[model samples]
Target: MSINCRTRAQRRNQVPLRIVALRFDFETSPQKIEQQLITFLRELRWKARGFDPADLEAAREADDWSDELLACSPSRHDSDKIRRRAQALADRRLRASGMAHLDKDAREKLRGLSDGVRVVQLPSAHRADEIAATLHDEMPWMAQATTLAWHAMRESVRSGAPALHLPPMLLDGPPGIGKSYWARRLAQLIGTPSEMIDAANEPAGFAVAGSQRGWATAQPGRPVELFLRERVGNPIMVIDEIDKVGDVLSNKGVNFALSNALLPLLEPLSAKAWSCPYFRVTFDMRWISWILTSNNRR
Candidate 1:
């Protein structure tokens, strides 16, 4: 084969570098020899052109270090390193996506973008007027709130808007009231996906990156790493029933990790790089459009 044809053929067969999904168990555990076989292609420096060696070396050293630790004790935890790597990958993706310049309109439109993701508009009088006209044939009160939300979102998205940060809205009303319904509709309008994260189930909440034992027992809240990594470029994360977030026993003493986690996100610049105490790596939540819902606070 001539050199040009050979090069063309190789290019056709080459697969792009992508994350090997991490799951801690019999299959993906450090104990499994196959886990190492799937070491990041970039990390192995196996003919990857234009790749950085420092990143490769760091990833290799991380895997090697974890292997050394687990070799001494088969039952000991080695999942933390893997979780950190996954978080790193997530952060890398965020930087790649240009971190879309978020305006109020963009954020409001986010909620309506998809399931488990939606745009939320805050209360506004002008929006109330517009919403009254649009949903005139539908429920009036619900329409009013939805309109206010849209207007607030619209103004918020405008140039030089104030940093109007507030705790997640608690949309409380009668049983048949359309709180969730409006939430879903707002998501649809924004054209983003939405997911309902339950703060009640701490284990499942933290398991998205895989079964790191320490994190499994960690108190429940939105997994900042998973949320930012997996759900970037989306809108409308509806954290449901946050008032019921439970207490978990920890080495530090009984702590409400959920409330603690949300507090930073509520504050501007606070969510920039929240270091997970369990994993010990920082994450960026500045771009996520969070709309939390709950019953009356206790």
Candidate 2:
């Protein structure tokens, strides 16, 4: 990697690293586990009441169900109500089962994000304009991009947004023009955390879109790691030399492409409920600021 980007102030606010250990049930309290078991049993009994397979079979043969089983549900039949309830329970179980790929350590790492990341908001519109002035001086070559950033900041300020969120930007320019550096600088000025990804080095979309659990190298993507590391919801992500990324990277008979993987994250609606392939967890990644720098249009 020829480029190294750094932002002003560089408020990394990086959390201390934690070494994950082996998985063990003893890690949790017996009382808590017992309580969970009790709750599950109670719910299971409630759902099973008057809805046993044997009872249903007998009712089918006799063509006469008990009053409780034949009662009409508000929106449907009693059987329909139980079916919906059972289906809902099954859905929750399936979702939890999908997380089987994650280890205890990985699960713990993601648990911290329950409260969500912090939001960095602009102090005022005037401050945004001032920052824009300073940006023009720092990298005059990126003036047009700077102006776009300025407008985004002004809009954020005017609307009293919780964070200074910017739209996805493509910096089309020749190399050695400080496009990557300027992106980091913008993150600093906006007080949002940032991560830089070299697309030339990425063999798959794991850097941003996340690697699946069954993959040889399975792990969460930068966006998820950013939220965990910086504790910020909206972070500036710079994908340097995106045009240099390969059309596709294949392994274990599975193909992955950075461009194709980014489609969901780039779209606002999909981004709001973006799911990480690593942990099988959904997250709202709408506020992520993307700056894709390219040397050519490829």
> What would the TM-scores of all predictions be?
0.44, 0.68
Which run of 10 residues does model 1 get worst, by summed lDDT? 1-10
Q: How does each model score on lDDT? A: 0.42, 0.69
lDDT of 1 by residue, 153-233 (tens): 555645322222223456655545666656555544443344556655642334222223244465323443333334322
| Residue lDDT tens for model 2, 1-298 | 1122224232344332221122222224334444444445434443566465435435534645445443312224533554555555544543444444556687678667544556666777888898899999988889999999999989988996666678899999889999999988887777777888888888468888887777787778887887777667777889988888776745575668788777788888999878778777677888788999999684
TM-score of 2: 0.68
Error of 2 at 141 (Å): 1.7
Query: What is the TM-score (0 to 1) of candidate 1?
Result: 0.44
Pairs in steric clash, model 2: none
